[model samples]
Target: MKIDATLHYALIFRDMTTEIEASKLVNRLAYEDSLTGIANRTYFIQELENALLEKRSIGVLLLDLNGFKQINDQFGHISGDEVLKTVAMLLTKSFPTPHFAARLGGDEFVVLLDGITRQSQLDESIGFIKTKEKNFSVLLGEQSVPVEFSVGGAYRENGDTIDELLMRADEQMYKEKYKDRPHERNSFN
Candidate 1:
């Protein structure tokens, strides 16, 4: 009788441990982008909401990879995936704690700057990202492909909603994307 009781308790503990691990995995999956291992859109939205509620100075930087489709078409999806993973690694490394980076699906990414105290800090951060963006390259087999992207950023202002902030950042990104060709700018609006 004593042996049976001990065995039953051990099994119960094992089951509980398994349940805890499974729950952790589910939570991670919900907040994380599977391919890039970075925060996903859901996580980004939650963080942004918290920042808004706390009344912290916030800056959002949106990035869109240039010629992403062409890379996918020419080198196959495996190489494209490698490029994305490389970029994700770079973003996370470049912008560590307090600053958040997420993949907003496809080749689009976003970074949230929290508790920013000055315009200079924001400008410096943007300059660093731009410099990194210009220098980084991904290795695909024997070929090296440069990572090129258009980035736009906006600082939160009084009476600004999340949608408005995102829209403004997106507009700036579009402007950067079409800067060379003035005629194509009208279609973005």
Candidate 2:
């Protein structure tokens, strides 16, 4: 039997397309958070390392959710899951494209933006983060559980190591977390 070349080519293309879609699905599952649907820690770290290797100017922002444990204890794990999902969506919306946002497990999340060495861009991103308090809450059962987060950010410095940047951001986050202290509010500067 003689095969029609056009039909054979079309069949091959259809099979290729199916394989491509399946591969994409697998990638998403591997790299995405099952609950919040954001990138997982592995993907986030990979991106950060890639940025560092490429010598790109970037800023790393870390956020630690406050009262999350209390909420989980008082409410339920399901409520906590809802809060995480909500916060993930908010970060995704706030830092769309060229900027990366990921859930680094539990209540810790990170946002990476390129060109943060530029003062205007850095200020704008930081301003948006600081002003996002109004959008961080989630509804749990009948009560509204406010999802509060403290943010710490560090810009890439010349010859800075990944660990240093992470530590700086983490330290800033700690200060933010303890902003109730008289001297903690301005510690990041």
Q: Name the candidate that leads on TM-score.
A: 1
lDDT of each: 0.87, 0.84
lDDT per residue for candidate 2 within 57-153, as digits (tens), equals 9998898888888988999898888888888898889899999799999999999888888656765776788789766567788877677788888
Prediction 1 TM-score vs. true? 0.87
Best by lDDT: 1
lDDT of 1 by residue, 1-189 (tens): 268566433343335888899999998999999999999999998988878777789989899999899889989999999999998999999999889899999999999988665667767777889999887888878888888998888778777788987998898888888899878767754
Q: How far is candidate 1 from the true structure (C-alpha RMSD, Å)?
A: 4.3
**Model 2: worst 10 consecutive residues (lDDT sum):** 6-15
